[model samples]
Target: MMTNEINKTTGLIHNEGNFVGSAMLFPFNGKLFAITAGHNLYGKKFTDVPNLDNLTVSDHTKITHPIRCILGDSAFAKSHDIVLLELDCKTEISNFLPIRFCTIPRNPKHSLMFRGKYKNTEDPVTHRAITYTSTTTQSEHKFLCQIEKSLLMNHNYSSGSDWLGGWSGSALFIDNHKELICAGVMIEIPNKGNDGQLLFVNTLPLKDLGFESDIINAENLDFDKALNAASLAAIIDSFDEKTIREWEENNKNSEQLKFLNRKLNEIYPPDNIVKNKNKIIKQLLAGKAYLTTELSKNEQIFKQYNSAYKVYNLDSKEFYVNTKAEALTQLSGIKSSYEEYLIGNLGDDLPTADIKLLAIYGVSEWIADCSLDFLKYE
Candidate 1:
């Protein structure tokens, strides 16, 4: 492995619309793939992933090729904020990107001990914060963070670390020198008032999210040299909640509706089984439409992004809450929390809704809404 001075850890988020995270490189299906946080690409447009040939690093064109976005309440947010993508790269077999990632499929293979220079402490909580030198900020202050925690704070929470922005999705390696190892995914910088630690999510806990299977690692002689090499195959378009649901609903309804119609035939028997042809046909059609609408509605709602709604017995005016909240209410005294139950066990299912393309205004307006991500499980 080539060795050089630890270069400045600054990444240029090129995915359209300023996805402020680091890119990951991994091997997938005989080609190199790049990974990013899923929520970063939710509500985007594109058919195929982009390549450097189409757009390069820090190019102003970044506003065009958006990353695929994941929802706040989805399972992706719970286990980990990770997404694997493919990149178009042509490199020699012997050469690998300086920072390469391993799939969670084999994440255990690379586990090792971490010694936090900033945390000062040795042991780290699995998803807790650690200390890392800030490249963007001029302050010598250490940052507080927790992304799949791998280190403890060297000093107590005197001040918080400032990741600035665009540091999420960054790959962290423990002991970059002798005991080098790929560790976690960076999500955000700690607030100035945070307990002086760098935040990151460990890739280990998120292995089950299928991100590792899609990782596209770009090997490099130097960290900076690996920019284009490390970036994932640009998502020429993203399948956001708005798009995924529509695509899934249309495709699923077409297929399931056919199946349901056949089932209806079993129940109604094609009218030939009875004598009143037009009357029976008309009655059958009406019933078929009603059932189809109900079931199809269920399937459609089930396929949308991280939202859960109760089949409100219109009689009950109170909005339903989830069991997670109910469980919390037992202690927190928010007794009404138990009413809304999550739509799915994993909260990965999509909600049925007519989705539309998100304009710049839509995103700006939802900044606060995005922060208050409604956890279906919660």
Candidate 2:
């Protein structure tokens, strides 16, 4: 439903702690801009914006280029978690992905496209590499919605790639008569059992956020060369082990062969899932304890901020509360409570051992909230 050319507009946005989220290039006011979830640009300390200066955009081939500029002084924080950044210079619309100008609930059957991370077992073909994927929405909420498929690498049910915590900010698009249009930006992974539902900031609201200028012009976009049937078959055949092995045997001195083998090993590295499970579960449980304590301390600090000023939602202006108590309730009630999050994510209903990975995700969400004062003020 999507083309490989989507790869050109997608890249990773690195957080303060080596944490990587996804991002995409957009054309606005006749200039190219980088867009992502507002949370990805926030620093761990939350006092000031983390430096993304000279940020480079990487492609599927692992090529990188610098972003021209970050539009405003800070990310446009709102209830939707969407942020629009200005590029340092103008670029051809062909260089970035195109956004769809459609009504909400575009269609129940629309295919969403994005470039996200995957593990060897989850997506053995492109582990550690940000690759293209097409998935559809299962349900939509008032502000955000869930992706029907999980993007984890080696889960219990399917051997397909699902998203990890690092996949935040990845752009979501739908195919409309072969035309790819941007829909939303990923913001969270829903912690409901083995279901790795992704939360995305719907981009249709960009118009209300001052991005309404010239968004629907198709002349600003470009399409990549389509792969013919024979070329597609040949490419798929190269993935065959027997073919690759024979090719290697024939080209004993081929550097390309050696490079290909090394890359394959990285994608499907030998590691026991059983051992990895035990280690991860133990770490998550211990981490939960530590974070619980930190959450209390963080709560007290937030109280100080709340008492000084009324808190505001960064993405959506309609949801500000009167008191810190009400605000905290709104924050925790975001989608679900911590207990629900733990129960839905921790139990054995899921197939993979990494389902507990959401525990750490819960911790980060709490930590980020503790610094809500740093986001935006009324």
Candidate 3:
């Protein structure tokens, strides 16, 4: 799960009709931003800012455009190359992995984990190692991170080339207790040398970027908002008005509605969901075609939904049975169906099934899990 989360955080940056390097989705100030090494966009020069129209980033699942770019302004920022691109707030960025900005100084004793995409691949990869030492230049603005060995050894590289060229903008993280604590961004391999040492601009300079007070500690990071956004995004992507309306009408007075309403309020405050409900519904309905095409590559997701639909119905009261005998029977039948699906015995039972069926069933399951009041009756 940690690996998957890391993969979602990093993405490929493309501009000028070519792949540049990699970038990570950074959440700050109740908004999302993309961060990468400054050199990726400015090249060797620090002052060169390119045309912003063509710059875009992709996680391979979706593409997002930057609304504005924020360059590093302080001496600390220029010494340690860094750039932040403010992403469009309305874009679906809910799938990004939650990360905490490290406010405290990095400790060399802790092992480091780096995640980024190679220039040739769409998916991101990871490298883990311990920092050998950290050096400070005379300018006192940057901290050079020297690792024990080459991170490129795990990859199949052609002989005679030892430079880590394609990983300029990768994110360096410290894995502490299953939480990803971002330490810095990989700026470059110093002088293109092959000494198995790399340079990272420590994250401490993020304080100079006007976000010092907002720097979240790994322990205090609240993931509830992100999780709520993810759930709402899924519903928007696979939206079916009839199914949702029916479910809402039936569960209006139930505890499920109360819990869901609370989550909705938390995500979009001041009753945004209520005020823009019709507009959002219309937009989601119109986007169905585009979303389907974009998600067609992951057919397994649809298959899982279809299998679950066959196992249970959203409107069925049998799923909320009061007796142990009835619960066991339902569980046994669901297990049997799942086993059959796993072995490919149930081939295309509902090939043309609406993906919304899965959404309804998923919501029902979520509500049932949250309110297990029927268990007391048994």
Candidate 4:
């Protein structure tokens, strides 16, 4: 069965602002805006949380839309996870580097596979067996649909997928019927294992948020907009698959390691010294020295993580990254943490040192050891 390829909930965010999560993007007043969790922004502006510098993931793909964030008026939009925003300074919206919704509307009352894009690619990639989740726990379930594709992108944040500290304001969206629509903002997630089911904010009105649990909309926004304006399909379908394939190939060769590179742009390492790679691999399987020192370098990778503490600031998600890097660089010395899916236990009343020790590790859903006495490092 071909699983419906759920388009990703994504938007290109630029400019400077605060009190928002990078996972949120919504259209407002004809100008596109980056929507986010209000708490992420309402903190001190430009520090420790989602700000312009931190929110912009790849400046090479900057969004030219106006940026603004005001306390959301749910009465007007009827969406609580939403906030009104305007872009900064002088910028006009362009479809060239257009935006996407992180969340997409769905008819649970109707039968359809949920799907979305995890990262941008030259050709639209499709995945089957889609899984969607939401963040709220009050008798209603909300979810950011996670597609189980093998792409090395945001496929597994709760399962060894390294979702960075500054990815909140970004929207999780789906590309539906050639037009892209948002489904939810990437709110915080529980990292223990369920991948922060509570952090997902589905655009669809979940029963917990007090909306129709079994309603489906037939009106297609993209089709109507195109007929009214006579514009091309939303950027997702507008792309030429061949051209994008070539572009993706060139990028992978330039960007990825030779062994892990995908088929689209896969190539061998240039050095002839790497010839007879299979023979060398066999020798290593038996016993070899090439890996002796090279593999040894990773022994104390956490030691270098001290840079985060040295450069601590109330502002800058970099600080958070540094702290996490510090704790994770030494996964060998670490034992499994049984915190039941809260990433780093941030919302807990655990002691400071225990919190520090746990914050630095990655959360893979593989069941952990249960019988061994627990170990907590300060």
TM-score of each: 0.32, 0.43, 0.50, 0.35
Whole-model Cα lDDT per candidate?
Answer: 0.33, 0.44, 0.54, 0.32
Residue 212 displacement in candidate 1 (angstroms): 6.0
Candidate 3: deviation at residue 339, Å? 44
Candidate 2 whole-model C-alpha lDDT, 0 to 1: 0.44
- Judged by lDDT relative to the true structure, which candidate is superior, 1 or 2? 2
Off by over 4 Å in 3: 1-4, 73-77, 103-106, 138-141, 146-150, 153-163, 191-193, 213-378
Clash totals, every prediction: 63, 20, 0, 58
lDDT tens string, model 2, 238-334? 3444443454466552553343333223222346433323332333333343323222223443243233223222333123555544544554464
TM-score of structure candidate 3:
0.50
lDDT of 1 by residue, 1-378 (tens): 211211212123444433434454444456544444444343122123343333322211121222233222234443355555444444431223344343221122111222111122222122212333333342111122333322222245244343233445555563223312354555544554343345455454445544443233312212221221111111112223444335335654454334333323332335542332222233233323322322133434333322322232112222233543442333122112212233232223322111111111121122112211122343
Please give the range of 10 consecutive residues that has the lowest summed lDDT in model 2. Answer: 120-129
Q: Model 2 — TM-score against the truth? A: 0.43
Best by TM-score: 3
Q: Model 3: which ten-residue window has the lowest total lDDT?
A: 219-228
- Model 3 deviation from native, Cα RMSD in Å: 19.2
Model 2 misses residue 309 by how many Å?
A: 65
